[model samples]
Target: MGGIDNQKKFVLDWMDNHAKELSDWHQVIWHFAEPAFREYKSSAWYVEKLRAEGFEVEAGSGGMPTAFMAMWRNGAGPTVATYVEYDAVPGNCQAATTRQEPRKGLSKYAPGHTDPHSALGMSALGGALAVKAAMERFGIAGTLKIFGEPAEKVRASKPIHAAKGYYDDLDAAVSFHPAYMLPMVNTTIWDTHCGVGYNYIYTFTCDAPQDWIASDKYSPIPQNHLAARAPGANDALIHFYTLNESLRRSMLPFTGLWSFNEAILTAGQATADNLTPQISQIDYMLRTDSIEQAEIISNVMDNNAEAAAKATFCKWKKTWVAKSRPGLANHAMAQATYDNLILVGAPRWDETAISVAQEIQRNLGLAPMEKPFLPATERLTSPQECERLMRKQMPEWQRYLTSDDYPDYTWHCPTVRLIVARPMLSAPQGYTYPDWVANALGGIPATIDPMIQSAGKTIGATLLDLFTRVDVLEAAKVEFEERTGGGVGGSKWMAPLLPKDFKVPHQYRWPEYVTTARGEEWTIPYRDDE
Candidate 1:
């Protein structure tokens, strides 16, 4: 840690040296803005760069066409795996200002870096290059792995990378993201990858008289066609407002639907219209810090989707999607890491001290008070009695209302909230956009630039330094043994064993489905009861 100045200088210098290249990479990626497995251009771009860098590059290794793995080795030593995400939020083309309006509606879909995942790829590239340079300059013996992961907005698909045995041989993994401030560590834990569960998207096509509807005689046939386009349509905001009201009344008990709802609404207002309204297809994953809560929330989700679909007369489709291993849980283990960061040198650590430091951070325009890694049961309880109990039992929640990252106060997080205003231009008479796509469009940059770079750099460097100090490489050995009940041999790595405790992950096939050539028999593969 004594070399804090030097290390900071090195990282900054590295970023500066690579700025042109990184920005080029960023711009290229920003321009393409591919989504998930469909990231052909983005993937090819990275693969070309990685190949030129003399790393062993493998394309289509993870049962995914868009995903790839690249590795470089200096000597026989511990393996460290890093990840890069290149998928763009679908259908969000815009001018590069911090604004929420599309310059003009796109004819063909033009993926935008609204999510700034391009920044993700750049960070991974930058960090990996820096570490490789460090290892070489210092003559350190270790293996450096950089994995190209896809589709984070929904599935998070990292578990798929795990299943591909991507992390199977790694000593440890590191990821840096763009955000508003340096969080010592992110507390929104619980990375639960789920199987593609099905819900009945019962489309009650209004079979009214021709004059009854404003549009043409729309049939269920064309419905599926425009469904995926829902994320890019003008009705997206209405969808957000409507869903918010719907969930406000009928949201299930102890479910993080509220969080999901808030995230969606924020996305809609800040991003695009297609994002919220024409949610013809719902692809959602449930995550929380507690496994018990995760399970309860999952059950609630299944029940709620089923109930909603049945009520709507939608047919059920069961699509087997794989959920990632639970998100990085922030229980005792993670908390210990936070506490350890304090034991080292953070500006402040304790609640009171941290609170004051948080104010300073806010003054600096950094997002304050990282979202708490709370359990679903506690956070999702919408009962009036629970609200009353909170006032009496956890007045701290009340105290922090002025500025707290409580689970219930998710929307209050300025970073998470998206402010909506009428677009400068009038909507074209026939103009439409995807709801979810648009929601993501407007707000994604806030997560990356100046925000994520500042936050991620500070936190990532601190974490890496701590790991180096505490001998995290060795600790991971013990952690693997204790958590997996396995020995600390080379097998003591990151992949989850199947049947016993893990299983092959489900694949995501979105916006595409199989059907008869005549279009008579429909096969909506992404449906709830497929």
Candidate 2:
């Protein structure tokens, strides 16, 4: 039933003819490596190329200056939406495939294609063009909407658009990501815009004694530095720390503390100095996937502000404040689109694929996978711990803020999946920005060998075929319950796969564990005993 319909045959043929051009376009996009919401040249190039394909393109939409939407069709059949993303992760800017040193040309951050959003644009374009050719050949009438979303690295733009009702009318949507497998269907759910941050500010003012004393007997005499307000100094320091502690306690486990020390660097027309001995202002963010959770987080942040203000300035405790973006709730509709794509011939790698990835890491002298499944508990603590969870070289904590609270139970859900049709010639170094670009370009460790990569793709494609089968989703909905000893339905798959009691390679750890040795990206072999 998943076989190419006469319409699909035409689409596939069109894809085969343009595969080389599409690959070249994707590679160039990878090399350009721009950051989110600021993709100038890359976005322009895509627009130009897309225009050549006969799409009526809108350059900016959704309140984002860089966003775009392109469409082609007779406006007759089911409206299907597809998306293309070309932004790179921030920091570690580079264009080399082999392990390269961090670009030292700048004092601060450099952009990198870690996530490889370049491939997303190419893949979507490829698919859309194929669809266009099919429509023209078979004279089939249908609508295809391709949206170029921006700032996925900074905020949950997609969901914001969805909340604005951008995707309400579509009959179905599809997307394909480059992974180790040619195609595989996943019964598991996927989530987008999973985190957020909130900022808070506070200020304090101290009053001085009013009576003037020049000299003796009510004279307006100035006192020595040590004699004036000495007690106030002691009071201020103790009060500040106490307030800080209260703030810490109030913070949600998933939320992170934005270092007040650093935030001051951005103070408008002002700088931290000796005169401002009294603590003046503060900022913070609360991150979670649930609106209810966010509300709870807000309560905690606000309560902390109030408590701290009261303890310090007494009646002046009124100097408390709060501001924040709501955490990005997972999109069931997008997850359904991802699942359906896999079911309809998208590639994916399974647990074994993760093992192979671990092996690849070891060959590069990288750390081995510690456990097969992601830990059920988030174990989130401090900014440092959350950074470790993301594993990217330049982690944007301000971008994805969530509580350390891991899901209470393991759902069969798959966070993200990829099919690698090609073997990576090298491994990316630790926390490298733009790692997703590498991941998108069949990013796998070189140590795993080309044969494994090829084999993985074979498995992935097979899985995709299964997903593409017309009735597989329905069939799996029933079968998964009996086999896994779990409840049935799409929502049931939301549970995470837990680390406990799960068997997996010791080396397949998250991105944070790997490091660069000498000049090459490598990790120590997994040592369970350690």
Cα displacement (Å) at residue 35, model 2: 2.5
| TM-scores of the candidates in the order shown | 0.54, 0.51
Report model 1's TM-score to 2 decimal places.
0.54
lDDT of 2 by residue, 1-530 (tens): 35545554555555557656665666677665666556666878877877887888888654555677777766555555666777765444543333433333321134655545666566666666666665676565666677776544433334434434454454334433333211121222232222333233333333332221233444344343322322222233345446656655655344542322211211111343222234343333344544455556556545555554454442123211221232222233233333333334423345554565455455446665544222221111222232344444324534433321111111221112222233232334453323423443232222112222222222223222222333433443344344335542344333221212222111212111122453422122212122
- Model 1: per-residue Cα lDDT over 30-118, one tens digit each: 66656655677788888899999878988865666777889888888766665677776544555443333443333223445543667
RMSD of each: 14.0, 14.2
Candidate 1: Cα lDDT at 186? 30
